[model samples]
Target chain A: MTDRDTTPAIEFRGVVKRFGDNTVLDGLDFTVAKGDRVTLIGPSGSGKTTILRLLMTLEESNGGLILIDGEPYTHEMRGGKRVAVPEKRRRQVRRRVGMVFQQFNLFPNMSVLENIIEAPVHVLGLSTAQAVVRAEELLEQVGLADKRDARCTQLSGGQQQRVAIARALAMDPEILLLDEVTSALDPEIVADVLGVLREVAETTDITMLIVTHEMQFARDVSNRVLMFDHGRIIEEAEPEVIFTAPREERTQQFLSAVLGEDTADRS
Target chain B: MSDNLQTLGDALPRLGDAVLVTLQLTLGGAALAFVLALLLGFGSRSHRGAVRVPSRVVVEFFRGTSLIVQMFWLFYVLPVFGFRLESLACGVLALGLNYGAYGAEVVRGSINSVPAGQWEASTALNLGHVHRLRRVIFPQAWALMIPMFTNLLIQLLKGSALATYILLHDLNYFTEQLRRSTQDTFFSFTFGLLVYFAIAYLLTLVMNALEVRAKNRLGAGPTLREVLRIAPVPATAKAGAA
Candidate 1:
C-alpha cells in the first residue's frame, strides 16, 4: 500500500455527545495516526472515558461524525442529509476496533478460554478449532494458560483483566481502546496488567487509545499524551514533554494537583 | 374395614389415570408458559412502542383476570362463538396464559439485574443484538430466574386442581369421587393434600437441582458433589481400611 493508504486510524470531526442536558463531548476534533499509542489523562467527569465509549459505539453521539480508517461508521452524510450508518455497515466498521473496560467485563457465564474465543468465533467467523488455538496462544501470552478452563468469576481481578485483554486481542483489532483499565485493580496487582499492556505496545503496531490514571505507565507506553478537561483537549505533546514540561497553565495546574498528591501519598 | 379396603382398591386405577392427566396438564402448561414468558418478557423491553405496548397488554390482561374465570370462559363462553376446545386444552391454555404473565415479570427483572457492563462488553465484541442476548445476557439471567420460576411452578401445580371446575377429570375430581363413595371427607381430602404436597416437594427438588447446576456453570455456586460431600475414597485407602 502507498502513503495514500496510510490514513489516520481514527479521526473525529467536531464530534459532540450529550446525555440529556449534560454534554460529555463537545465539538471535539482529534486524530490518532496508524500505530500511535495515545494516552488521555484527565480528572473524572472530564470526558476521557466518553471519548473511548463513543469510539467503541457503546454510546451514540448526538452530533458529528466518527470515522474508522477514513470511512464513516456512526453517522454518514448522504444527499446533503445526515443519517445513521446502517447496522450491517456499522458492524463492519466496528470490527476494526476492540475495547477493554474499567470493570474487566468478561462474560461471567463463560470460562476464561471461552471468553476469549467467543467474539472471534462468532463475530470474526473463525472456526471453533481456529479460535481455540488463537485463544490458547493469547491466554499463554497473558500468562494465564493454566486458568483456561476456570470460570471468569474464579479468577482474581488482575487475572480477569488480563483475560479481557486477551479477549480484545483475539479479535485482532487494528485499534484498541482501554478505558481506565487499571483503575479498578488493587495497587499490587496493577503492575501485572500494565506489564502485559507494555509488552503489547512493544511487540505490536496496534493503535492504542488509553484512558488511565497511571502516570508512569502512560509515560512508558504512549508516544503522545492528551490532557483533557471539560470535554476538550487542553494540551497535546510527547509523553516526556507533557509529563515533564507541559506548556499550558491548566496542564501545569492539573499535573501539580495530580502528581503532587501522588508524591505526597507515597511519602 | 374390609368394605373400605374394597372401595379404595376400586378407586385406585381411576385415581392413577387422573394423576396422569393432572401431570399432563401441569407439564404441558409449564412448557407453554415458559415459551410465552421468554417472548413477552424480552418483548416488554423492546425499544419500539408497538412491540412493548402489546406485550404489556397481554401480561396485564392475564395477570389481572382470575385463572378460574379464564378457564370458564375458554370452555363455556367460547362455545357460543363457534369455538370449542377440549377440557384439557382449556385448562392448559388458561394456566399457561395466567402463570406466563407472572413469569414474564421474573424474566424481565432477572435480565435487568445483569450488570450494564456485560451488555457493553458484548457490544464491544461486535456481537449482534440477538447473539449478545442469547450468549451473554440470557445465561446469567437464566440462573437468576430459576428460583422465581420454581415458585411459579409450584403455584401452577396447585392451580391445576381447579381443572375440576371445567369438568376435566384431574386428581381433584378423582378425590371427590373417592370421598362420595367412601363417605369419609377427612381421609379423602387428607390423601389429596398429601399427594399435592409430594408433587410439590418433588418439583422443588428438581428446581433446586437446576438452580445449582446453572449457578455452578457460572462458577458461582457449590457443585453437586461438594454440596453432598460425596467424594470417593481412593482404592488404596479403602483397601487399607478394610
Candidate 2:
C-alpha cells in the first residue's frame, strides 16, 4: 500500500446519479490507483452497475465531478462551480474507456470481424486494412478466430460475449469496464467466458472497474473489492480481508447470501 | 349522333393520357412525401426544442387538414399572394405534405423499434451521432420502416384521386368524361377501379421485394432468391455441392 503512487487512475468526488425520484448514487466518492482491478459487489440496485454506467457516460450524473487520470471527466468547472459537462467533453473521455455489457450487444448488422473493426476504423480513424489485422489478432486472443465471418446472431451466448470482449479490446482502451459480462450466460458456458476474462486480467495492464456477482471470480482477479449498499460504499478492502474477515455486519450478510455459506468466521 | 357513339378507340387514347397524369401525381407526390417525411422524422427527434416543436407542428398541421382543401389553398389562394403554381404541382404538393406527416410517424416509430440495447452498444463503441445512425441504427430501422412505408405508398396512390378535384385531368377525370360520352356510369367507374387496383398491387409487390432485400441484409428471414423462387429451392444445391 505504501508503494502505491499518488496519482489516481480514476477518481470520484461527491458524484450523484438519479433516475426520476430515485437516487441511485448519492454523494459517492472513491479513487482507484492505476492498474488496479476493483470489483463492486452488492445486491440489485445497490449502485454497482450504476458506477460503471456513470463512467461510460451511459447515464448522466445529476451532480458532482468524475475525474479520469486526475482530470475532469463528467462535470467541468465553470465560474468556480461544477456543471454537467457538455456531451463533447464526455465523448472525449469515453474514447479511452471501453465497456462489455451483460447482454452481448453485438451488432447483428455486421460479421464478427466487422464488429471488432467498426469502432477502430470509423471512430479511431484507423485504416481498414490495419483495423482488420488488429481485429483478427484480438479475435485470436479471445479464442474466436474461426468465427470471424459469422454474424453475431449465429454465435452462442459465450461466443457472442467473447466477440464483444474482442470488440472492446480492438480499440486499445486504457480503462476497461466489465458489467456482469457473464451474467447472461448459461452455467456451462459461463466458465468458458470467464476463462477469457481471467486471461485478460492476467495479461493486460488495462485498469478495470468490474461489477459481478461471482465472488470467486472477483477474488481471483481483483485486488480490491468494494461492497455497496443503497448508493454508498459500505465496505471495501482486499478480497481476502473482505471475504474471510468482513468487518461490517452488512458485508457478512451479503457475503453469506451470495456465497450461500454460513462462514462468518470472524463474526 | 356519332359523338354519342364515341367509339372505344378515341376514348382509349384520351384515357392513356389521363393514366399518365395519375401516375405523375402518384409517383411525384410519393417522391416529395418521402423526402419531407425523412426531414420531419429526423427533425422531430432532435434534442433542441426549436427543431422538435416545429416539426411536430408541421406534422400535425398537414395531418389534421383536408388534402383537398390544402390543394385548393395552394392552387386557388396562393394566387392572391401572386404565387400561382401549376395545377398538377398544387396537387402534388398537397398530397405530399398530407401523407408525409403520416410517414414521419412511421419513420420515428420504426427507428425507435430498434432495441435500446443497440443504441447503448453504439454509444459504448464511441460512435458519432451520424455514424451511429448510418452504420448501425438506420440499417436496422430501414427494414422496419419499409413495410409501413408500403402502406403509406398505397394510401398515397389512392389519395392521388383527390387530384382530379384540382383539374389535374387524371384518370378520375377521364373516367367521368367516359361516363358522359358512353352515358353509362357503372362501366366507367369499374374500369377506373380496376386500373387503380392493378397499380396498387404492383406497388405492394415492389415494397414487399424491398422488404425481403432488407431482411436478407440482416440475415433474419428467407433470402430474396427463395422468396422470388429464382434458385429452384436448393433441391439442386446438394447436387452442386457434391
**DockQ winner among the candidates?**
1
The C-alpha TM-scores of every prediction are 0.94, 0.93
Which TM-score value belongs to model 1? 0.94
Q: What is the lDDT of residue A33 in candidate 1?
A: 94
Clashes of each: 0, 0
Instruction: Using lDDT, give the best candidate's number.
Output: 1
Can you tell me the DockQ of model 1?
Answer: 0.45
**Where does model 1 exceed 4 Å of error?**
A3-5, A264-267, B1-6, B228-242
User: A215 in model 2: Cα distance from truth in Å?
Assistant: 1.8
**Cα lDDT of model 1 by residue, A1-267, tens digit:** 766468889999989989999998999999999999999998789899999999988888888889989999899899988789988999999999999999999998898999999999989999999999999999999999998888787788899999999999999999999999988888778889999999999999999999987888889999999999999999999999999999999999888887876663210
* Fraction of native A-B contacts kept, per candidate: 0.72, 0.52
Model 1 residue A240 lDDT score: 100
Cα lDDT over the full model 1: 0.90
Q: Candidates' DockQ values? A: 0.45, 0.41
Which segments of candidate 2 are over 4 A away from where they belong?
A1-5, A261-267, B1-9, B230-242
